[model samples]
Target: MGTATGSSFDTETLRRGVEGTTGNTLLSLYADDAQIRIIDRNTQPSHPKVLRGRGEIAAMLDDVYSRDMTHKLDRCVVQGDHAAYCESCEYGDGTRVLAESMITLRDGKIAEQILIQAWDE
Candidate 1:
């Protein structure tokens, strides 16, 4: 995590949030009006799954974080008011999921996020 002043996106905070999502404590890292877009094979580019606002985002993420799996943040980069990261997770059944996300920040919180993910079928 890099340190920078006068920027809403804090690398340390983002790192903590990603690591804490499994603990269900990452909601604090998002703004009340944050939005999230998910794109994958099921949810194609033509029909992406979109979550609006903190409440919706939180609900969706809560379900994800509650899953029985182990999460790892493989890579992360923060620049200006934007941040990006790649994460991988493995479930007990040997299924694995890989996700890459781009986040936009506002007022030190996550305002919007776009994620593309793939999973073992």
Candidate 2:
């Protein structure tokens, strides 16, 4: 991982990064050493699945963004290096989510992110 210098986490930056990627902007933002892990409770054996490496995560998001449309975020709360947010997003076909996310920062860059998503009817 290459060292990242002069990165800062503010409401605007986080919002832009998330909205850009989730709102059909096709833009990606990641820490040089960022890793995303997910566990779906609905699936069998709920173990963490690591989306290893920054580049892979970015590419995965690219595939996601290509098929997704608008994302709307609301009810955001942030303090220090942690944030919790809620989102209403629409994706391909008719897929949509009312999701909540917890975000953590390390050295002013996104270090960890976890999301809990529920399908909206």
Candidate 3:
């Protein structure tokens, strides 16, 4: 786990946060004024789903945490104040999803994140 340049961003912590996805762990990795943009089949590039602020992000994470799925982080890289990772999830219903995220850090927390996902249909 590497630190992002002068930032205090801990790659290990971020990895755990992403793999866990529980509200507490995940929320701890984000800044209060963080924003998340999601792009996928459900949320196309033309009309992406955006979550502004920690509250909305926490709520969205809570919903995800409640789901019966297994998450695995495949790869992660961090440089300067930026980090990127790929994760795969398999749900109880045998559905699988692959997600890649690019994030920007501020004060050791995620300030902005863009995520793209593809799921089995």
Candidate 4:
């Protein structure tokens, strides 16, 4: 792993952003022109659920955060201009989810991200 590029990508902020009910803090971590590609049982590698810009990202985050669930940031690794993290979530109805993400950073904010997640049936 490489050292940080002296940017402001703090893991503490990431923790609060992911675990908090509101998506405000999380949204702030993304660049204005950021993009996110999500893959899951529904969305495959050939066709990912892509989110362009903060507008689309915010919508997704809001929808996710509004759900009755608990989110935890399990682990994170950071290198030069890049990062990866694992997140675990459990819904009110006992459904569990695990997600892994790789992100590219620019000026301390996330410029691009690719995420793959799985949910318990």
Candidate 5:
């Protein structure tokens, strides 16, 4: 395994990753840790789900991609090893949102991801 630099969380890197994510992009290609946890606090109970590993994460992305969703990265801001991004996306089922997220990286890999939904209808 290649050593990850802490700076991998730079704004540009994160922007590229978020913008570069297409329907064909696999989630495994992004997260490889077994402890990867993604939390969407917008829910009542604070839905916290674990992706397990890269493979499962990849599968999740694949499922989304299979729906032919379109994602647009709007803005990205970074400070130190943390990055925040805003994205406007439209899913195949017509679910659209302008979401913002904060990503933290450790050892050059995504350690935790927190997302909030902000849709402008």
Candidate 6:
């Protein structure tokens, strides 16, 4: 496992990972102990879905990337030990999903993240 010199998050890696077809690239950006909080229509903010550790996160990523869909990183900003990004995805049936994430970084890897998303229903 390699880390950056300080608290700098790597946006280039993020761009490469987000646009990739598989989850492997994006998974590499997370620390082993990372956690993610997801909020959507099915999961409200009052009781959001939380994924702990790389195992759960990886599973979720794989499932998402394996689907017949397209994902794009619309925007991203990184500062010191934090970052935020917007992601847009479209399914084969033309269902569109938009997600925005606020993230915390540790050792240049994603330590924790809270993502809110909405989908065409």
lDDT of each: 0.79, 0.62, 0.86, 0.92, 0.57, 0.90
Q: Of 3 and 5, which scores higher on TM-score?
A: 3
Full candidate order by lDDT, most accurate first: 4, 6, 3, 1, 2, 5
The window of 10 residues in a row where model 3 has the poorest summed lDDT is 1-10
TM agreement with the true structure for every prediction: 0.87, 0.71, 0.92, 0.95, 0.65, 0.93
Clashes of each: 0, 0, 0, 0, 2, 0
**Where does the lowest 10-residue lDDT sum fall in candidate 6?**
1-10
Q: Across residues 11-120, which tens digit of lDDT does each residue of candidate 4 receive?
A: 78899999898999999989999999999999999999999999999999989998999999999888889999999999999999999999998878899999999999
Candidate 1 lDDT score relative to the true structure: 0.79
Q: For model 3, how does the per-residue alpha-carbon lDDT over 1-121 read when each residue is reduced to its tens digit?
A: 5555466777776668767847677788888999999999989999999999989998998998899998888998887788899989999999999999999987678899999999999
Considering summed lDDT, which 10 consecutive residues are worst modelled in model 1?
A: 1-10
Q: Which candidate is the best by lDDT?
A: 4
The per-residue C-alpha lDDT of model 4 at residue 120 equals: 100
Error of 1 at 34 (Å): 0.6
Give the top-scoring candidate (TM-score): 4
lDDT of 6 by residue, 28-75 (tens): 999999999999999999999999999999999999999999999998
Q: What's the lDDT for residue 11 in model 2? A: 57
Query: What value does the lDDT take at residue 55 in candidate 6?
Result: 99
Per-residue lDDT over 1-121 for candidate 5, one digit per residue giving the tens place of the 0 to 100 score:
2233543444454445455645333242254663444544445225556666667766766665555567777986656555567888787778786767676656655655666665434
lDDT of 4 at 87: 99
lDDT value for model 2: 0.62
TM-score for candidate 1, please give it.
0.87
CA RMSD of each candidate after superposition? 2.1, 5.1, 1.4, 1.7, 4.6, 2.7
- In candidate 1, residue 67 scores what lDDT? 81
Better of 4 and 5 by lDDT: 4
